[model samples]
Target: MLTTRLPTKVEPYRLASSGKCLEGVIPLADMPRVVEAIGVQESDVRISLTFDIDSQRRSFIEGSISFEASLLCQRCLRPTEPEPLSSDFRLGLVTSDALAAQLPGEYEPVVVENEQLDLLSVIEDEVLLVLPQVVYHEEADCAVSRDQLASGVEPEASDAPAVNPFSVLRTLKDKH
Candidate 1:
């Protein structure tokens, strides 16, 4: 468990140089952005990070985040837990895109704004990346019956055929 309230921010460069490792749980309630995105859920997300100076002498951070999120199923209009969301990432601290571009593809570029790396923002971004864009249960598993979904009862095709005004134009062309 992390300290009472997880750290809201950290200085990545300094931490990496010092080679500090942090493993903790961030209560769902402590993450406003995550809460705002996923709405309220039952459990806390686990956060683990290790900071070190890479071979290239750059400060880098690597970590994994895991948590369960419940999203409303579009088909049933009920909440469903799709899967336990978890992901691992590597970040290279950089202040500019030029520096970011130099980093290997394996590491994501984390821009340091005034030397501070926002911990919450990073975690929220990782979680959102793994979340489904459109949440829905499998058709077979949906609580809403298939018939209910397909019940798109389009008004019975109107009994009368529509008259095309082009018919009059064709008649006028023929008369001409």
Candidate 2:
């Protein structure tokens, strides 16, 4: 895939009869947390986009994306290489003035231009959206038991006092 940086001018911005689109890889290993959490075994991003003018009033481009990323196994905290998933989305672009009038205050807008498409931003969003909330390690020869305690000792705690914090608070309140 092409680098994450946006090109000088995205094709969609220009008032051209036809616009060209690009697709390529973006190296996200720079994000340490993302790399550590989602250990990518093998990843490739595929993007298909088109830019066109809509009735001389608005410019628009549609993007369809598919990518593969690995998730760390939850059981052993190891990397689980899963197949890539695809995401389909579209972005709308308008001038700052138009956006101020039409878009919500909290909404983010993508800008289209004369030469290239801002594919990197879209890819980042897609990856972020698809990342699983919890990554689980597959059950291979390396499954860790949930019952096992970290101290390597049985979880039976009989040598403890039967005092409760709430009870102490109640006694203090009564004394006052």
Candidate 3:
């Protein structure tokens, strides 16, 4: 766990050239997009990033992000217990679309403008990607029970034989 706040922006090329590694924390409240998506956020996001020039001569950032979040439960429509979420990503830093396109499939291309990358934005993007599409508590913990979900009135059984509309069509065809 990192207690120091991370820099919001950095020069990826410079970091990569020096083989720098950054480990820090970003307050969850600072990321509005994440807050909006998760509904509730009360903790800091732990981030670790290593910047290096790979053997392929590609400058990239390998990052890991972890955080606890309280997401709205799809079943109960309420906030669930804080759940841990994390993501690991490798981003190839590029200054142009051509360079971005040349990056291999293993590396997701990140375009740097004016040689400066918004580190927070990248971290926030990873956090968003890691969020569960539909959050739900364990069956025992959920407020809405399976029985309630399956509780619709069952159709009453009748003694009469079922009538088929196709029977009339069959009768007409036989008469012809």
Candidate 4:
């Protein structure tokens, strides 16, 4: 629902102090790392972020991002239909590793330099985290059939009893 374009860069500390909320869209093509990982994307990524200082006086950014993208189907080795991906995250803004380590477990630490943060990069990283490790279409829709997946032939059942490789080891132990 957010149609406004989000700013590419901002000072998280300043925004957190003012308790600002930003909602907007970022063109998917603008994120190089995401594009490289998932291939070309035509849809825009919708994002919402709220910056505030917690009771502990730690500056943090809470945000959610949603987008649609086509991922390569592992079974078919082709692009599957566009799938929706989204993630919600809480990140504590920190200037150093020690400060980051001090943050509570619930908040992931995001190190900022010169008080500046790249909003797009942060959003893109979240998108990557939410991407499926393996993608596949529904069985009915997949180009590769179940039989074809088994190399187009049903496995034959052998008449002989199954042999256990461990039987030799068992015999050796018995002799010992």
lDDT of each: 0.82, 0.58, 0.90, 0.90
TM-score of 1: 0.77
Candidate 3's residue-wise lDDT over 79-120, tens digit each? 988888888999999999999998999999999999899999
Q: Predictions ranked by TM-score, top down? A: 4, 3, 1, 2
lDDT of 1 by residue, 5-35 (tens): 4587998888898898888777766667777
Report the CA-based lDDT of candidate 4 relative to the real structure.
Answer: 0.90
Better of 1 and 2 by lDDT: 1
Count of clashes, each model: 0, 17, 0, 0
Worst 10 residues of 2 by lDDT: 1-10
Instruction: List candidate 2 stretches off by more than 4 Å.
Output: 1-11, 15-19, 23-41, 97-108, 111-118, 138-142, 149-176
lDDT of 4 by residue, 1-176 (tens): 23399998999999999999999999889999988998888998889999999999999999999989989988888888888888999999999999999999999999999989998888888888999998898999999988787755657999999999799999899998
The alpha-carbon RMSD values of the candidates against the true structure, listed in the order shown, are 4.9, 5.9, 4.5, 3.0
Q: How far is candidate 2 from the true structure (C-alpha RMSD, Å)?
A: 5.9
In candidate 3 the C-alpha lDDT for residue 31 amounts to 93
